[model samples]
Target chain A: MSVNISKPSFQPYTGEKARISRAFDYLILVLALFLFIGSFHLHFALTVGDWDFWVDWKDRQWWPLVTPLMGITFPAAVQAVLWEKFRLPFGATLCVTALLIGTWVARIFAYHLWNYFPINMVLPATMLPGALVLDVILMLSNSLTVTAIFGGAAFALLFYPSNWPIFGMFHVPVEYGNGQLTVADLFGFEYIRTGMPEYLRIIERGTLRTYGQYATPLSAFCSALLCSLMYTLWWYIGKWFATVRYLNKI
Target chain B: MATTSEQLPVSLESDSKIPWYLQDLPLYLKGFGILTVIYIGLRLYQGAFAVASGLDSSEPAFEQYWMQLFYVELAVIAVFVTSVWGYLWFSRDRNLDQLSPKDEIRRYFTLTMWISIYTFAVYWAGSYFAEQDNSWHQVAIRDTPFTANHIIEFYFNFPLYIILGGSAWLYARTRLPLYAKGISLPLTLAVVGPFMILVSVGFNEWGHTFWFREEFFAAPIHWGFVIGVWFALGVGGILLQAVSRLIELLDMLEEAP
Candidate 1:
């Protein structure tokens, strides 16, 4: 809770420090410039699905898993710097919020405003709240091990329930051309037809065993456990990177 | 107790004689030898199994091309790492402690420059390139494990940032005395954030390999990655705040009336 410690004695920045900072600033600026230009091209390509755009090949089962894992990169790295140096507890939350904000804003602008797709069909993902909860849990616990074990587990467990309000509506059973399937199956059938056939829908309809209707909870549990294991390793790496013990001036 | 000035350097020199094995040449050579051995071993393994078997043949030509691209990427990364470390080591001044305040600031600035370059490299790989590539993948066909998106996102972007994250930690520890002393929250965030990113990558790739293809905003698989991203942004904000506080202190010192 009381993570902040007394500030260390301050020393004036030497000329070398200023010079290094300026150089760093220039490099950042240049990189930003390139990203700006490149992003536009990327945006255009994404809009039209270029040659290398294989991410569209996945179905519901895999895409959700892959995207968030990739998405966590910046937040975790940022937290390492923030929590270690400034005692900020909101690192994970803030990073997740920014990304979600950016992603959602992009979705709204591109899909909703631009009429690229309907809101109901192409709505932005809603995992940020879960992420925020995870970060808050970690902050409250203040132990990486605990965060990974418990917080990570909670993160996964909360995933389905968190989005159930929106996604659950789609879970209703529907009698279609060949058989009766959940609304989830229909939605996937309608939108993801090419790769995701009706058979891919992992729902319950009384024929299967293992509580077919409880697939959401089972999936969420697995995901959360994986996330916890991931957090444990990354926390240590984050700590390692924040180290400043080996400076030698040129 | 009387000491002779002439014998000082001679006596000190003899006492300072490092063991043969501890000498810089042997150490450098030993490291290089180990690296060489590891590299050869890995290459041999790849040739004997991956290439010798028809596993490589099973992949589509496009996937094979992308795999080659990944190798090129690895080479480029290796070059950059070697160059940066070489520059830092070669440029180090032995008499750094005696530098004046202005000189020290200049040195710090130089170090920051290096750090910025490193950051730029990371952002390009992690954010800009990765995002753009994701957009492409979301729209394209998925085939093989090393699809274009996986190549950029999981292989290139994730590892690059992990390295950058490590570099940030190393930078803070080496340059800033404040960081060198003990753990600081911002510093911890900086270091820990990247590691989480790396771990999150495994989940991400696994999700792609096994599950659905379409990008779902509400999937449990994505929650971990999103959390990590948010943490990284938070770290950035905290770093800015810390720097601002430092600036304010410096300004007050300058204007002391």
Candidate 2:
């Protein structure tokens, strides 16, 4: 159903109008940078907290599954507004990059400097490659369906490999005290945390570990299936929040 | 009858060098500078004292270093909220109906600055300090609710950001014509939703009482904050509302040279 408006079409502004608009854009740029860093990081920290924070918690099962699942949420919601309204496809990259900056700073100052934990123990994982791909798919396809299915899968699938380089050395096996533990597990033993309780560590449980070699891919695929659904759900959620409705009262 | 020069809109006759759209830029920058110092100062205080006297709550030094700061934070929050909100409310424009398009446009710019500053406060409270809470908890045992980080984070930082967010909402409601006439849903959702994060502190602290320490960061007990921060996405709608109104206002003005 096509609809036509009698009002004159809006045209590109020049001179003072352009300057005012550009200035507003800068203000928005600054606002959005902080907004995503603060809000998305909060959400990521609380939901994907242990997995992203500790190297030992970055296991074959939960870390691969939970990280991408939580990571895609803000990017999808942001893409809904930014891509749908302004035609800006950088929403995923913007959110991911902001999250990285927030995580890195916290890891250095909060974890390493203040608490004196080693940097490697608290290093944050990167989702940049996946975020880049998500933005690209949405920009090229311009279909929420295609983006959700393809972009969402790519986001989950690329998370592990992208982060592997930063975390791989920690996964190297070492023999100590009649038990073999990865270097990451050694960090957990060396550092005493309130979260160091045996029951609290929810990593690599169930029969999935028996599949040792195939476990990560299996988790990633499970996350891929979940993320596609999450991306679509959040897209609508983003649209709903972006509503321009005015209420007469509370 | 001919129109007199005195009858022209004040915006049209302004001789001031500052652009009408950016008149609030100095105040905005000042607000940012002040907040940065406060956050950094708090961080420094934690560095110096958190490990020394903050480890034990029963000691007199804990009362001095930590509890005193908590009490002061509560006082500052009370005074700051009352003064800022009261000033915004009492000094509200009573003649919004008579607001010129140019003046209305300028108010929108100011409103954006208020929101920008609010988000800046959120960056400190939500990203930097919020994660630091985990770092602090991981190392330091939870003896009291008013631990060093909690004193700075829960008491000071969270409330400071809430005040700024509320101020942004109040500023828009009192000064802008559309906001004064009808409450903007997006604006309300964006402001009120994050405000709930402050409310969820009760739940969070209560849960911590059971364990006396953080067991897992992603546990169900901490989900309250995650849910609350999602409402920040309402900013998308606020943008749409502002842009649509700005377009109409800008169209009413003559093209600049």
**C-alpha positional error of residue B253 in candidate 1 after TM-score superposition, expressed in Å:** 6.4
lDDT of 2 at B100: 94
What TM-scores do the predictions have?
0.46, 0.95
Question: What tens digits encode model 1's per-residue C-alpha lDDT throughout A1-250?
Answer: 6788887797545663454345445544443332222222222223212111221222234333433443344345545655666576665665555444444443444333432334454444455666686677767876767767876666556654565575556546688997987664454445433333344333233432355554444555566667777666666655554444322321
Tens digits of lDDT, candidate 2, A1-250: 8797688676789988888889889989999999999999999999999899999999999999999999999999999999999999899999999999999999999999999999999999999999999999999999999999999999999999998989999999999899999999999988999745868999899999999699999999999999999999989988899999999989
Across the candidates, what are chain A's individual TM-scores?
Answer: 0.62, 0.95
lDDT of 2 by residue, B75-163 (tens): 99999999999999999999999999889888999999999999999999899999999999887788788888989888888889899
Native RMSD of candidate 1 (Å): 15.0
Query: Deviation in angstroms for A240 in model 2?
Result: 0.8
DockQ result, candidate 1: 0.05
By summed lDDT, which 10 consecutive residues of candidate 2 chain B come out lowest? Answer: B7-16
Q: Kindly list the per-residue Cα lDDT of model 1 for residues B1-257, writing each as its tens digit.
A: 76699889787767865431123334333533553463344333332433223123345654455577678768866875677555545654555445454443433443344334334444444444444334333444454556554555566556655665555555544554444444455545544654575687677668867764654323466556545543343234333533553454345333322
Question: Number of the top candidate by TM-score?
Answer: 2
Native contact share for candidate 2: 0.85
